[model samples]
Target: MKFLAITLIVHTPHPATGVVQSTTERFREVLDNAVLAEELGFDGFGVGERHEWPFLSSAPPVVLSHIAALTSRIRLFTAVTTLSLLDPVRAYEDYATLDHLSGGRLELIIGKGNGAAQRELFRVTPEDQWARNAESYEVFRRIWREDKVSAVTRFRPGLKDAEVWPRPLQRPVRVWHGSATSKESVELAARYGDPLFSANVTHPIEPYAELIRHYRERWRHYGHDPARITVGAGTAGVYVARTSQEAVAAYRPVFEGNLALQKSLGLEPVFTTLDDFVERSSALVGSPQQVIDKVHRYHEQFGHTVLHLHADAGGLTRTRHHDSLTLFQSEVAPVLRRDIPDPPFPWGPVLHAPAPAATPLAR
Candidate 1:
């Protein structure tokens, strides 16, 4: 299985203390984490987009552009770009530019964003988000794949015989629909035959598994080859250690604290305890064997080819975060790649060596 390290730059102050890192420091930490992810042999590094307090990832393209200049090999991805809230023309321009700067290492996962704050920021209502998202994505796809496009849409301005400049470096940039609760996203992905990446962060695996099944069914319904369909899944958390007991003991405090915050915010408390999270939710916190088994179980359920994990949450220390990434990369990741089925997407595009000038790490 291809592994991606998703960086959700969250802010809830330090768990040990009520103090919060400065905004500048927080941004630096995120950049540092991306650089470290590349050094650790992570297949992909993804950043999320959120326009709200307690999250620092509103400008995914800009951040990813900086990362692209810094790193040479690791693929850069957006966990979910809020397609519902942006002008497709501008989004296309920014991402296409980024694709060029990254030497064609950019991938996108589009979604109808959640959170009331985002809707307020974009002046979009919940009722119109799905429609807007569909319309925006349709325009965005055409803008990327087609040379000249003319479209009249609600959210996007009309283009009359005008061509978007600096077309993406890739012929057609790869896009994966970020499916969580919306069947619209699933159906849209199916109709277009694009890959679907399930947001398996909040709830248990059953709902997400069902959504994946529906995606594949609809993919086949659209006369697309089922074998051509690709699926990527996110996990609630991942922290590997030498033993399950130690993993639980170390991760329990962070898990419990995160749960408390969720409850306070009136969000659904899916898995209330660490044990419950490990047993039911997709949080893979345990020993190497235990982590391997959890992933195998998820593969059996959803048949995911790309697996993204969040190893740092609730403000875990840098040391702990590095340790988790090291253990997983050294022990668990290799096991999954050996045992899991080959990913539907060609690894050549992602894993291919870059040109000498594009490869800056040697410098």
Candidate 2:
């Protein structure tokens, strides 16, 4: 299985101590974390995009470009680029440039982002959000694949033989659709034969498992080979220790703080306690063996080939956070890699052969 360390760049104060860092320090923390993920041999390092308060990830391309300059091998990902709120032309240009800057190490996970604040900022109605997302992706896909494209859409002005420059280094850049309780996203992914990444952060596994089942069913319905279907899953959080008791104790404060924050934001508290979170949610707080067992259990349900653990430490100390990841790499990843197989496609952009050049449209 491929392992990715991902962060939303949340700017909340320390849950227990009420301490916060300067914006500069927080940004540095994210960059340093990306470097560390590369140093520790993670397959990918992802930066999320959120335009609302408590999240500093509004500019993913900017952040990922800096990460690209610092790391050599670790693939950089937009945890979920808010395509619904962006112009596909601009989004395509930015990521396409990033693809070249990173030597084709860029992979995108696109979605209709959540948050009322951002939807209002972008002037997108709730009724039109899914439609906007689908249209944006359709435009974005063509922008990456074809040159001098002409298209008309309700969301943006018509493009007549427009050339989006610095085309993607990847022949057809790999895009994974981010799905959370949305059939539109799943069906869109199936229609295009792209992979699906489950935003399995909140609630129990059944809802997410059902979504994956739907994705697979639609993939078969679309006449795509079952063997070509790839799925990725996200965890609630992760903190591994030598024993389950030790892991729980270490992560208790973090979980409690998060639970309180969720209530403050008017979000429903899915798991009341840390024990419940570990039992129900995708949080991987346990001994190495226990963590492995939980992953295996979920694998049986989701058949996921890629797994992402929270890169943000939450309320844990930096030292403890570093140690947890170290332990995960040393203990957890090897066992899982032995048991799980990777997706059929290459993890990063395929760069050995030159992609076909785009032909100009006839006037």
Clashes per candidate (backbone, < 3 Å):
0, 0
The model with the greatest lDDT is 2
The pairs that clash in candidate 2 are none
**lDDT values, one for every candidate:** 0.84, 0.91
Error of 2 at 320 (Å): 0.8
| C-alpha TM-scores of all predictions | 0.94, 0.96
Query: What RMSD does each model have against the real structure?
Result: 6.4, 2.4
Task: Please give, for residues 178-210, the per-residue lDDT of candidate 1 as tens digits.
Answer: 999769999999998899999988887888999
Which segments of model 2 are wrong by more than 4 Å? 352-363
Cα RMSD for predicted model 1: 6.4
TM-score of 2: 0.96
